[model samples]
Target: MRHVISLLIENESGALSRVSGLFSARGYNIESLTVAPTEDLSMSRMTIVTTGSDDIIEQITKQLNKLVEVVKVVDISEAAHIERELMLVKVRATGKDREEIKRTADIFRAHIIDVTDASYVVELTGNQGKLDAFIGAIDPALILETVRSGVCGIGRGDRVLKV
Candidate 1:
């Protein structure tokens, strides 16, 4: 099964490398990953997407917790949460294609951030499926160059996951 692991770690050099190294050492594939500094610069959040059996996932959690720089580790795949992803897609566009792309972008609520005679860069933020659908619709009309900030999630309602 797929697992979304959210790790809070000390914001220091080599910290991310160490975490990623663990997965590499075990030959586990990371489907997606995103890391950024939190309000407290001393810490950062690493969101990783991977797949494995129940026993392997349990082992992953245990090994991750053993890292001294790790503050917390959470398996959020089963949590009640709201998850989102951000994507930027640059597509080839010309006069008529530009108009069509703009119209389609409006439908997806994606903003055209840059435009040139031959191409356009669009920015979008939404759940993964919505982004995928938006990209799918735009791909046929133009050659697409894509960038995605992986998944990020927070618990639903008033609940918060404990560290």
Candidate 2:
């Protein structure tokens, strides 16, 4: 099973390293990780995506808690949650392809943030599926570059991950 684990940790050097080390030592793999300082700059919130069995997921959470810098760990996947990722895709747009690319971006609710004579930079935000679909919809040869922000999620409704 794939799990989305959210953590509130001290914002200091080595905190992320320690967390990643624990996973490396345990031979668990991180599919995606996104971390940034919270409103309180002294702390950071991290969303980690990993695949494992239920028991392994539990163990990962337990070990994360054992770290001194780790303040809180929540398996957001265990509850109702909203997941989102951002992607900036640059595609070749020239001649007849220009109109098609613009139309496709509009259909996907993506914004053409930048445009040059031969390229368009599109900014999109959605779940992984939507991002993948957008890439799939474009001609592979037209794709110039892609930058992605990994999954960042939070519990839905009234649930919150408070440190």
Candidate number of the best lDDT: 2
**Candidate 1, clashing residue pairs?**
none
Cand. 1 Cα-lDDT: 0.87
Residue-by-residue lDDT tens digits, candidate 1, 1-163: 9888888999999999999999999888798889998877899988888899999899898989999999998888777777899999999998688898999999999999998889999999998899999978875658568999999877678655445
Worst 10 residues of 2 by lDDT: 154-163
Q: lDDT score of model 2?
A: 0.96
Question: Candidates' TM-scores?
Answer: 0.92, 0.98
lDDT string, candidate 2, 9-97, tens digits: 99999998998999999998899999999999999999999999999999999999999999999999998999999999999999999
Model number with the top TM-score: 2
lDDT of each: 0.87, 0.96
Query: Candidate 1 at residue 5, lDDT?
Result: 87
- List ranges where model 2 is wrong by over 4 Å: none
